[model samples]
Target: MIKIFEKRKIWYGISLAIMLIGLGFAIAFKGLNFGIDFKGGTILTFNMGEQVNQDKVQEVEKVISDFTKKYSARETNNTEIELIIQTGAIETEQVKELKTKVKEEFNLGDDYLVQEENISGSIGSELTRKAFIASILSCIAIAIYIAVRFEFEFGVAAIVALIHDLLITLSVYAILRIRINSPFIAAVMTILGYSMNDTIVIFDRIRENKKKLGKVETGELINSSISQTMRRSIYTSLSTLLTIMMMVILVPGIRELTVPLIIGIITGTYSSIFIASPIWATLRDKKDKKNPKAQYGKKKKTSEA
Candidate 1:
């Protein structure tokens, strides 16, 4: 019995506020800290020959600390610990020396070995470009598909929701200062997929219900459709969220990836229900005023003379 569509302004206001906060942080803080994947650096992956619990992680940190102290201003390593450490952009020779020193200084069990990758900022720049392209293409594809399947209004509303979800998720990163890296790109892409699916389901329902319930106000039809799908959305989002929470707790290395993914899921679900649906109803109503066929206002009956 929630007047979700009737209260569209409230949802829009809230979404705007959240986005503004994120944008404000981005502007004030100058943007998120780019990880090695974006800025380019040396990545070290290793197995400690045991479970990668907190103690093992802390031990690895101590070892890196020792290495940095000896190397002084010549080197630095940041721990993202899932058996991975990032040493800010380094030279080929410095990389070789760092590998030798890691072996000499750190004692992993005889069964273990370390791996390293030297990424250039140029490579990171390429990744950034590719990520942006992928996102834009995805939005375009979704808009086209929705327009073909539903209406132009639905397409625009869905894209608005996509922007809403991504902005809010990225805003969290900006506010929290989470490092932007390849994993962050992966998370954003994955979120787009999830957000699109959730929005599509609601859109599909609205389209179906509009057909069945003729002569109803657009807001009434949308509210009905969203109400029907509410439980499903909650179930889907909650299940995914709990799974991600568990992974973050159980896995030591991928927490960096999983945590942001969790935020994306929640926001994606919310935008689909609260933001996307309401916006669609508003758009559909406006379209109805402009053109009768472009609406859910009243269906063209089969027996019309």
Candidate 2:
């Protein structure tokens, strides 16, 4: 019998403290660390014909480091080896120098520099706008679905929990100075879906228990509902987490996607158990207090004619 409602403030306070710290870091750093995908930069592609060893790749990276530290190097997984390097805007001479050095150092052919292009910052701005729109639409759609399936308060509470999970994920990215790339938005959308599903499960339990245990103490009902579903939430999240953790450890190319997934899963599970149900209970209790006659979960009787 976990008293989640009784310790509501404690849970809220803990989340507030963590968020505040993240806000402090965000303020100190001036904002999140947006990567080249959001902030336009130069892209250099080379065809190495064969996959280079780790040491060789490091040597090539060292050459690029001379021009800009904010850069990433990735090799293709196909049969033919293709390396793509991205970095912040650099002078024409610098780009030429970098290309020459890589070719000379690796003893490559003239056609080694296959492609080079500079992306505009405006394109990144457009992407940012689209991502923002997509997130808002997702929230709206989720709220509508939950409201229809359960109730308006349940919908609102679930949205709040989803927002909580998003904030926590963003906090981690800001504190760690992780690059907010295109994949970041995809990760966020996936997080919202996962968080919403977990929240709906608890909300469904609360609805069922309300029918069975009429007029029970609001706090007790909420606590019991959360407690009943807590184990299922934990087990499901843990299993998913283990799979994602394995991806993060073994897969290097997709770390951007997997790392955010790991953070989201943890926060999603926490919010589902600790945030959503309590919020719904609080809202119902407040409404009940405001109007004694129109009490929550109180059925009305019709007058006989």
Candidate 3:
């Protein structure tokens, strides 16, 4: 055993060191560039009434930019050019006129239309609220599930580890100034699901070893559990991360989601092995000390009925 628990301070320090950098940027630079989905925006899907090609996409982007420059300079900063979906944080009137100008510039007839989807600020606020609620519920479910299956100590440690993974991922985004959006929230939830599974496997091993090697120190059991599961955790994270990393690098339009996915997977694996399992072992040891009868071989006595 390499004294993994004894050196927990190092592991925890490394995590916080990275996180503090991100926190500094967040406070100083106004945090992430919240995307249209979270900040409310207008989406114009141009039905070109023809086979949409790269040339057409570029033409549409140019026309929209040129027209917006004349009328709404402030709105251009919040704009984006997707294939047919142009999203921006412009006002309601600007959205309608921008669509009309693009149609006129392209000489498109009635058959060719520009569909407008304007998400109001209130709606965006509502979406933000729902996303937070969903995240909270997911965390609660994870804690409850782990407590039922393992011990309450394991549950608390698992949730703490989960928060660690999420904060680290957010830090990466904040440092890079990546926009946080509705999809980002969904990604976080997905990462938590994967993270919970990984943590559970290590916790399961620790529980089994406690049963089999009844007299070992809790730290020694945790070290054994981590070593046993380290390979599986690394391989699973590596494979998933490679695929997403390639997609983020090579894919044209999905950088929004892929970036977060990559960070989340790496953090999830790191937390499972370094943060979650160690915390659980520490808590389990304290629990055992407080009530020695809780050890595997000791059975609580029931009053004679």
Candidate 4:
């Protein structure tokens, strides 16, 4: 089998470098297009009485785009043309007006179906705040749980891995210009929980090894524990990925949700095994060095004297 954890430092360094590059892109580009969940905007979904043609859709989109451009009160720098459409619940009268205009312009009959959703600035602000709070709280809860289960160092290492996975995922979003919204928030939180679970499983094995192999090098022990747990982790992640892939490709109305889940699960699993355990081993080694009892011959000298 491939020795993934044999060069733990190199793997960790590569992951860190990818994360930093992604972070820089995010900072420089502001973010992948923050959806209306973060920055309030209107959403409209409609079907013409006749089969919708590309030419007609483009024409209608041009008019609606111009209308939004003039009426939009927010200072949005990048407002690209909107062609991709999806189904969503709408909640405002202005959306109805836009639909009416589209129908009139296209000379559509009553058979045309139109829907509109308008989110106010204040509500968007509240949603954004809640998302931020939830993410922080999740990290705190995971830290407490890990610390209680193993040790403080284990908890710290898990959190570092969690943060690393999150940043890397977000950076990809920024670079790809994916829309960030409530669903994205859900994805991030879900990944955090999943990542921590994987870390905990590995940590549990490490704890077992620590008890079994007394006085072994920390690095060697970590490597052994990780190797023992590698098969189970790969199996679990592959099963989950299969389900997510099915949803993304086969199911309608779930493409957005499944895409992020697939990305999160893959990255989360990788970080837990490679990033979290290695960092914990490194920290534990440092701690061991600081203690006289952990030295090679100190215990023997004390007993003899």
Candidates ranked, most accurate by TM-score first:
2, 1, 4, 3
Regions of candidate 2 where Cα sits further than 4 Å from its true position: 45-57, 73-88, 109-117, 297-305
lDDT for model 1, on a 0 to 1 scale?
0.76
* Candidate 4: C-alpha lDDT: 0.72
Winning candidate number (TM-score): 2
237-259: candidate 1 lDDT, tens digit per residue = 99989989998876635766897
- Candidate 4 lDDT for residue 93: 59
Positional deviation of 288 in candidate 1, in angstroms? 2.6
Q: Mark the 10 consecutive residues where model 3 has the least summed lDDT.
A: 70-79
Least well predicted 10-residue stretch by lDDT in candidate 1: 70-79
> What value does the lDDT take at residue 265 in candidate 2?
89
Better of 3 and 4 by TM-score: 4
Model 4 per-residue lDDT tens digits across residues 41-128: 6655555555444565567767667445422221111221122222232335545666788778877777555444666667878998
Residues 123-239, candidate 3, lDDT per residue (tens digit)?
778988998888889899999999999879989999999989888998888888877767788788889999999999999998888788777766788888889889999999899
Model 1 residue 22 CA deviation (Å) reads 1.6
Looking at model 2, the pairs that clash are none
List residue ranges in candidate 1 displaced over 4 A.
46-113, 292-295, 298-305
Report the Cα lDDT for residue 283, model 4. 74
TM-score of each: 0.82, 0.88, 0.79, 0.81
Candidate 4's C-alpha runs over 4 A off are 1-6, 49-63, 66-98, 105-107, 111-114, 294-305
How far out, in Å, is residue 162 in model 1?
0.9
Model 3 has an lDDT value of 0.75
After TM-score superposition, what is the CA distance of residue 197 in candidate 4 from its true location, in Å? 1.3
Error of 4 at 217 (Å): 1.2
